[model samples]
Target: MATFSSVGVGTGGLDSAALIKKMVDLEREPLAKLETQKAIVTTKISAFGQMKSLVSALSDAASKLTSVTGWNAVSTNSSDSKYVSATAVGGTLPTTFSVAVQSLAKAQSTASAALMPLGAAVGAGTVRLEVGRWSGTPESFTPGAGKAPVDIEVSASDKLSDIASKINGSGAGVTASILSDASGERLLLRSKVTGEEAGFRLSVMEGGDTDIGSAANTDASGLSRLVNGSTVTQSAADAKATVNGIAVSSGTNSFANTVSGVTFTAVQVTASPVEISVAKDTSAVSSNIDAFVSAYNAINQLINEATKFDTTTGKGALLQGDSTTIALQSALRSAVQSVTTGSSVFQRLADVGITQQRGGDLAVDKTKLAKAMNDNMEELKNMFRSTEGGSAEGIAVKIKATTTSLLSGDGFFKSKDNSLQLALKRNEADRVRGEARVDAFEKRLNARYSALDTQMSKLTALNAYVAQQVTTWNKSSG
Candidate 1:
């Protein structure tokens, strides 16, 4: 549990502890060198990990430029968003349309005539509910054709609250609630969905004596009284709109597929038409190019730093002179400089204002890029995402392929990482063996010193006793 700094006390007048330590230190010196080697390998591994991350980032940025949809994005502008707003997706052609909002869709609702107190009993009955649509001025309610009606049974002792609960739990397309006001208690019902097709009608069949459920005793009437025409509150209506003078109707405010790849949402009624236009989203393509340039520069910087030599310090970087790193840098530069042979006027990255500098980093000219995008958009697109393949392949595709190979399982980087890890393991094993040998040598030295100290102590005591005898004999003879 504890370790001693020295082995012996030197009681026999010899510094045996210091001698033992010197021997042990000499024997353990090789372990220290092995530790240094492990540290160097670990640093190399860390550097390689950083290299992989930078390359992966560049690959992700390049992938965005390989697909047509990535650059075919569109943007929408609505002159008046108060009444309607629109959005367009990729492949939506550039065009303009006029949108007019007439009316918003509404849900049907109804409230019963004033009944007795909240707890007052209503006669037992079977309430049947049907969902359908009603149209035309002074609307007429008709049960939906071919649709089954939901039937709910109530007991004679059921109170007004119990009736509402039963109707709510009947799985009908209507919701029921009890509303109490100065007039007393009433049942309020509303359709679960908006629009005319979601409208519903309720009819009741009383259970017992007609006296307790008669229309005359409206206060204690059966559920049938709730369906009277006078109780009708709000009527359902569909949303009406117009696009370029063409009438359009929807069951809800949100309309889709009415305009190709465009979704229109009606907010409120508008007196005048609002102009909606879809245009090519050139800004998005510019942003993608910017990202690619940024990522490419980052990888370039990392590779340069990892392989640079410092003349002042007379030392190179951690990965300096490494063949794998050198090869990767060369391949990336070659991929970028390679010409893309396509039908487009722009055949290379420089054609689009992306030029490589002397240090192997890319720079962008915003003005040139914008002009190219405007004048030769189709040709520019083909230069970056052509499907011809081979030597005519786009720069992005080429770079992506190169990075993918370098980071693969059996790739250069992976092989180097495997070798470094193996070296570290071997160094650790050597350290362990060296430490074991040092410990065994120290134990042997301690044991030998302990035996020598005992023998010298015995001899010193015996010499003192013989000297005392000789001195006494000399004194007596004098």
Candidate 2:
């Protein structure tokens, strides 16, 4: 851009500002071309960046198949899932066994006599809760180790509802609520866990004057009335089950450690033995293969779009005719199609039902792959896992190594990006220099035009003096 404030005003009637602007624009032509070139290069760099990300993602997916031990997957099934459900927690040999659930675990529950109104005041005292196992018909008391009793205080004006709230808020190992019927309202207590050892006992002592009850902490009045008159609605119980005719018991319905690497949960007592089976997880292996295919397809798609050329439009993609991009596309295709060079039970990806499609993407054959994973498991593992020597490495190992190097420092992508960045820097420098030249040109034009204006003014003054002299002579002569 250029501007001239006092150009062509004296000597000529020309649009000097417009002329200066045109000249400056001509001078800036090179800078505009430079900007266009920089934009193209920057676009190329961004495309390469996306390609690198996809290759790195492919590497991650490949790495999962490089370890042989990681493929030790197993699936478990239960014949009667309604009664018992089984799961494989760790690695174990494939086997089948019978489970007979004799009884499910049950929590202990107790209820007070339904004789008090909803708001009827009950005597108050310090009620202590002792948690432990309850056994035998006589029900002798034994304190659980490391469990200190929790004591709660009650006032004379407190109703059964208030006691229930206090019990719930005390953090005791039991839940309390009030149940109402036509007869009256009764307080109900249940153990927090469904096991014999989760049972709790309640006793009351003197809290203050008039709220005191029997000194033995058991009587028919005060807070002790709840425990003394409460009936055991459900006794604490443990789950009982049999595995291969051997009896097994658990405090809860879940039986985790009965079998090595196996856990089963009982929902109901089985009429007969429920069979549980464990086997190699073929579906898991298939999923891993699918992940590998998906990652490879992503890389393939990016390269295809970036390098494609349209014949009808006479236009090419960003990476079209780029030697580096072509080489990358070729290398990835070769890696997938090439056979394993090292000691593998299976030689190539195709040997295990994975094959390249028309556009260089991989596709898995579900039925064939499942059979290979089931019957030829060891061979499939060896094909995907690496051997000690690099000469006989697995396909995954080779792809991992290649992708890792490409993403590393001093790789092709790094060098290309660095070169493009330098070009950008140079572009900016060239723009600065170009602008400076335009400024110098504008200055020169202003100087030349200023001198012409001064010269023209002097000539006009001299002409006026000459005209005045001629007019005086004519008048004198007349």
Candidate 3:
């Protein structure tokens, strides 16, 4: 009789489960290769996305330089900024002027006589508030037109704090507060706006039931003390100034449209006139040019690195053999190098101190650019933003248009990305099918091995029984 030990449920003593796994792995090798290829495509798509973003940034920078307003910005300077400050718009002709700030506008305020306590009750009354201008030595009051007076009613039981709250919530363009001194607490009121016309006059008439004072009393001891006559603390006044020695009056300190395309704001009164000058801001134009150059160079650098091939390492970038990236780089370079035919002095970017480097990046010559901007500003502006559209369009405009077309929905990069995404989907589907086949093969191998193991065990059992019976017969015969 012969006996066999179980080795992975196989009659031949082989590990069938391990062998089946090895076979399945061999069969799925192609699927693994597909996964690797999908990874490569995904990386290439990411590289293209980054390149598109750089190109878009460059386009935005170029678009800013395509307008005269973008380059012709101006700045105003005041010799004594403590007295006045000014701002100017683009294309404002350079000029110098003398300015003197005489006085700033003021708001009117009034306060009542000292009362006993903040919560003490005062006489009941209806106080009518009106916003108007005051003039003349005796101060003749005329109510403002188109502005209806606001009236607030007070009761005999209402405290000073309650009266203040009622006046504040009445929308009378006056704010009320309780002020305290060594004598006692008093109610103070102030106009919301500045200048003479913003002044407010209060007229109070006593109610039938009174608490602190007589109903007909018009003296300081009565509720009528909050009026403008004896309670006036500060008078309202308008701002006065002089520009180029000419007197100028304004209701407010901030003066817009004082000079053409200029705004002047008075800070403080000045004893002598301050010099305010508006000039052509060449530095601003230079800064814009530098920004454009930097943005263009950024895109150029990205394209260069993404498309380069290294012969020494036998390695290449993700976009090395990509036709779309090659075409994009060529188009961007051509747009930057194109010349404007209509411009007289400045026809190309090189004419205005922007020149291409050996590596396709743009370089700016600050001194040369400043000279060009000063000598031929109109021609310089036209070179970058020509209104006569077509092949004669400016370089900035051409570059902007090229980038816009490339980044559109059906653009080159988008189409390439879509194709890669489709390939990834196909790869995933193939992998899934391969995995299913492997699983089915593994199940079949396990079932066959288990049946064979049962048959081998039965044979061994029968052989052992037969050997025992033969031994017993041999002993009987002996």
Candidate 4:
């Protein structure tokens, strides 16, 4: 065999770095395309989520509209016809209502006499008097003992009434009043509060002739007994006071009681305007029905958009013609049809002026609707507003239940959204993984190319060195 020179053997470089570089570059296109597709899916999913939230709110509002039974409202107006009046039975309860009530009373005890200043006494000489509670200064006055309290006054203007008033106002734990009955206007004194410990006591200074009741030398403790014999000793002015025939523990006072499931609040005087009414709010049912219809329409639109696909454009519908969409559409249509076998008022949709056109869409017949609203409003209300025990008693209930189910958690929209979200997440993960592979492959290819270029340059330099040496040897030998 002929000898093959090392130059020829080493001429063809063993490096495939350039080929690897070209392969890695070609691989990047598929990964980039996948990333773009994933981004598009993410945008579509986010939009669908927002739409789902709005639809859910509309559905909840519809359910509330359908279930309303009575209007609970308050009005401060005095002349408004809606005001509920108190019952005729002594205390106030709403008109057309009966309330069981028991009356109560408050009273005072242990106080037999009123504190009198010595100035009211009939003594020939003046005696100083002080009337005030403990821990306070007394208001001083002078009196002449044993006479009409008015005649014994230290001043021309002062009388029994004036002295009683001053003593009562002294914060001495008693109240004073004028009892102008058949017995004449007597200065009546009573305790401010109804308790044995709260009764008033007084001291008379420098006058042995004064007794509390005499007006003569009406001593500090002169009024020792009640004016009347109806005992437990109430002030004479409070003789008629009684609460449900239960004797007051002491003196007369207003009281409140909650008895026999009725609340009775007594005031010193009756002041609040009594109210009574017996009419239902008729517009509430109609408003509820209208709200339900609007919400149903909203959900219908959402379903239609989600499941429909464009045949000409080859694009999937937003929710595109899915089973959930079809079911919702059918259920809503049936509910609006208003089938009632027993009720003459709501036997069909046409009765209520709801018409289904040839395009499979509902249209409101305003003229017929107005007639139905005016003539058979009660029947219409019964058809949609009445429900019992969690079951659809009417068209309105059925529609509300179904709409709520579809929009709430674990419902059609939620279930589908979860699926789509999972799909999007997986797609993005795959795209990212593919990109990473592409990057690593490219880096390896470039490193190989650099190594190959360095090796080739060294080989070429060695070949030049051998050629130069050969030329020098031939020249010397010749």
Candidate 5:
């Protein structure tokens, strides 16, 4: 009655263990099918995630076209860019103007008397720098309004190089450096920006004992030399120019507000007036159109690939024959082709040179598009942009509406994804129950087979004993 590890060890080698194994495997067929279905659902859900992202991108591109402000970009042309260069933005009316550059703004620069000896101590004290305007031959400084002096303290052992480092790190609105020459190194100070207000003035806040001066703030000794002994190399001045025959002055060379919505930078004084023209920027319109087309094409390509089927290989894509995806493809194409009477200018995409091709992708006719934009820009703007007075929705508006629905709370993506998740849950539940049932079945088969082996073993022993007794009786009778 001893049990053997091998399943086919008893029952006259009937191999009941192998038979049980085959039956158990056959029972798992349904669960295997469930597993395959679960895999398919999972892959389809992942594919939809990709589709939703592309649709969102298309929506973003469409949203940009819905705004009227984005279309107000203008192309500004200057007759002489060498003298004047300009740019236009933000609802600037198309107009031509004349500009004459008389002078370019300059920054004030100053130098101190050379402190002889290469490594001479420049005296210890605080160097106070002020941003202001300077005038007169001897130089009288007026600090700019609301400006505060930035102080840089010096140590007794500090050389001109150390003091220069401290000044440069002080954020004093002026750059400082040591200029080495035959006499020695001198402190050079220059305004960081070109403007009358950017001019800088230096004075020592007398402190550490070294070279004391009669006039601590102005005398030519110690750090005071940076002020009293300094001479102006250049004077601060505003850019002098005239726009449309009216003279205008700017602290900097660039004038942004002289002309409404038009900014021009004076590069140099011109011999004659520079003519400036503001025109509609057709290139920006073209770029927006191209972006929309590209975004739409991306969605189209994704749908095509996701639902594609290969007949030769007997294989289909993850979302092959999906109704939701197919409907989306048709709806988008219909939106592009639909005509809306709300727009008074362009009723259809084709009117703006946007044509749908045979492969369901949009193509742009650049020459035709340019002509349409040049001929009637307002109408073109009305085509894609939403306006007041409640006209019919534009093409972009229509497409964006569709995308919003698909990505919304009760949208197709959410609904479809939720369904797939439920299917996965059901698949797991079925797998767990089916495995448990098969396991119990295998255990039952084992128990029954084990009992059969014990019975067969006992019968074999009885047969052997009976045969021996029969042989001994026959021999005795003989």
Candidate 6:
């Protein structure tokens, strides 16, 4: 039988195939490791991006703290902050200064002359106002030419609330409403149709029209005005309600006469004091700064993870000593160091106890911070909120403008993240491209092994056939 070589013929041929196979097999581990590395890098990049966002939020919050006078976030546990003068706190008293009134634009009591007026007297029935033409006869109601009331049927599933929605949605020339008071809830209907004839007529079909009283129809058991106690009917749009001889407007009335020049709007009729106190919100400003500091710390913690070097693990930080991170750190440090000139407030980080330590880490001076918070509150507020001309308008506005320019799409954070993402992507792509080369190598190796198998099988068959033929020839010659 023909023998096969234990080792392939040439070192550069089958030997190279085995070497390539070994190399390909070895590549699987590193490729997997590279994939893991890519994941880690992606995670770091994403975390940094999140850190950027959080820092931006923190900075914004801080800016708000610095600029806004009364905008503060108090802890739920803090009792110094109070909701004192609001509704529930002083229920019987006029504690709240805020006022919101129902819109009266839809409260139409009169219309121009195009509508048909109801006749002298009527009683119990469903008042279905059918649109029609005017016939001089009081009972002869004819459909108006080129005019029709939209046909709308209110279902049992629909409540009084749904009626308004239905009429408004049906392209109808009317609106439905419910007028609520101490008496009860009354269904009110008005016309969306403008001008004199926009108002529709009402004719009861089921229940008695006892509640259908209007300025136009009062003789039919319905009152033009619901008389109750000393209450009076108002007809004009500009009418004001009086309170102990004080002229209070009906719609969102503001009184600048009270609270030492403080304008307060009357919301409801109450026997309470109409006084609201406005003071310098010092605690609020402090709490806001504290919250901003907390947020900044949270972001700082995340960034620290990426930049930290672990001495115990003997492993480098995920983004350890990254130039971009270093640059950002430096920029932050410099930005914090930059002082606002000609300000009466604590303009520099040192004034607020934020300083760099010997270990290159940030240190806080609690006492200094407290003092700065207390002593230079207004100054700090100005430093944060002061405009280019040192005028205090909106603190958040100025801070947002500055920070947005630093962290926006074309800003430092964006530019750095984008560059890092591209670098990571390129590294991952290169790694994947390198790993794909192994597939071709693996295929070539398999092909070589298959050719070797076929050649060995053919040689064995030829050797067996030759050996059999030789034995037969020897036997015949003997």
- Give the winner by lDDT: 5
Model with the higher TM-score, candidate 4 or 5 = 5
Candidate 3 structure lDDT: 0.80
Tens digits of per-residue lDDT for model 3 on 230-289?
A: 478898888889888888877788777677877888999999998989998878777777
Per model, how many backbone clashes are there?
A: 0, 1, 0, 37, 1, 19
Residues 123-235 of candidate 6: C-alpha lDDT, one tens digit per residue = 22323444432235443445556775554443434444454465567664556565555554444555553222233444322233244323334332322211111111212
Q: For model 6, what is the error of residue 107's alpha carbon versus the real structure, in angstroms, after optimal superposition?
A: 9.4
User: Which order, best to worst by lDDT?
Assistant: 5, 1, 2, 3, 6, 4
**Which prediction has more favorable TM-score, 1 or 6?**
1
Flag the better candidate by lDDT, 3 or 6: 3
Score residue 246 of candidate 4 by CA lDDT. 38
Residue pairs with backbone overlap in model 1 = none
* Residue 194 displacement in candidate 1 (angstroms): 3.4
Candidate 1 residues lying further than 4 Å off, grouped into runs, are 1-10, 13-15, 112-116, 119-132, 136-178, 183-193, 200-232, 409-417
In candidate 5, stretches whose alpha carbon ends up further than 4 angstroms from where it belongs are 1-7, 11-21, 79-83, 98-103, 116-121, 157-162, 179-183, 208-214, 242-247, 268-275, 304-317, 353-360, 363-371, 389-391, 428-478
- TM-score, each model? 0.83, 0.76, 0.85, 0.49, 0.82, 0.57
For residues 1-478, could you state the per-residue lDDT of candidate 4 as single tens digits? 1111223223564435445645875987887777777776676677566556655665565565454433221122122222211212222323332221122233332222332342343222232222222222452223223311321223334444664566555555556564444433344555555433233333232234454334443333332212222122441222122233333322223222322222223223322222223233344544544555566566566656666678899998654655655775676676666565433567565667766665345556667766776777656655555564243365556656666776778986688678778878888788778878887777766665556666776888898999999999999999
Q: What is residue 327's positional error in candidate 2, in angstroms?
A: 5.3
